[model samples]
Target: TIEMKADKTLSSVLSARAFNALMMVDFWNPIYSWRRAVLMQYVPGTASFDPESSRYDLEDAFITNVKKSGLYTQGDRESLEIQFISLLEVELEQHQKRIQAYLNHARDRLKTSEGLLGCLTLAESRR
Candidate 1:
């Protein structure tokens, strides 16, 4: 979890329109479907994610510590993969809902505004 400063803007706290534009362009625009994650894992293994120092690597703690304990039985990787996929699907669905609501609000704003593009139709002469 990358903690922002206490005075972070609302847009910073939540997802912004720029993120939506990128999602539309890069990943193929999604309407009813939820967005997909870049990786099935929490973080890809490498220098990018250091379990020793990063505050966000808590997911692997169970596999590393709890699984390593002598008293505990080893987990089934296939079952764990199934559960992780289910959990991620739910998370992405919620994110999709939020982005949809945000886009709706933006469209409403544009519709109500007196800006040039706000007019219902463009005249051929004006072009």
Candidate 2:
């Protein structure tokens, strides 16, 4: 079992978002496939792993770290918030595009399978 410390900034951010961690291990076993149990230790400020929230947090961390590193001109909190919102919008748009593409692919595959099934039925009827 490995123990890890959460980043102080991330801990503070998560605490501000109302996440308090209890010392526990979340067990996971795939109902249909896996029989082995996977144990995950819950650490403070790291209990939940929501991808969308994680993405936003990562962006926020990146912006703050970059600003602190003096790589870019530091903006006021309002401006930073605006920038973060814009970044989130862009990310959401990209995710939507990916979802649409996946749906289109599934639709195309269904069409192809239907066509193949029809051909097979016709062939079997003539046989």
Candidate 3:
């Protein structure tokens, strides 16, 4: 019960942080576009841009857009993109591991509770 209540607060905090991060990344960034592409890969035909396109194509579009807005160079783009994607992948992997661990813990707790309930039922039958 306490965990559920805490999760409500945690959910709000996480949603806000996620939204902030999404804004910070900006829609033009290839990383953001690539993330969306990867997430939506399983869906049917899309109304917007095709998600099956190469990440390099996405990066080129990002570079072209950025160049239109400001002075970004071709050389720095690769280095910066490599760093951003690598760091993002590492963070995502860590979150996945944490989620898996939490699920395993919850499953063990459920099994323990079920075993206890079974024991109680057996005792009631003996009476």
Q: Pick the candidate with the highest TM-score.
A: 2
The sequence of per-residue lDDT tens digits that candidate 3 reaches over residues 1-127 is 0122322333332233333333233333434455444322222231222236411133233333434332233435544333333334345455456557866775675578786687578659756
Error of 3 at 78 (Å): 37
Off by over 4 Å in 1: 1-90, 114-127
Model 1: ten consecutive residues of lowest lDDT: 38-47
- How far out, in Å, is residue 63 in model 3? 24
Better of 1 and 3 by TM-score: 1
Model 3 CA RMSD to the hidden true structure, in angstroms: 18.6
TM-score of each: 0.24, 0.25, 0.23
**What is the C-alpha lDDT profile of model 1 across 1-127, one tens digit per residue?**
4444455444532234323322432232343223324222323242123436432333344234333443333345434333333333344566577667877775775766463354344334345
Model 3 lDDT at residue 69: 34
Clashes of 1: 0
Candidate 2 lDDT by residue in tens digits, 45-84? 2233344544224324433443443223455543423333
User: Clash pairs of candidate 3?
Assistant: none
lDDT of each: 0.40, 0.36, 0.39
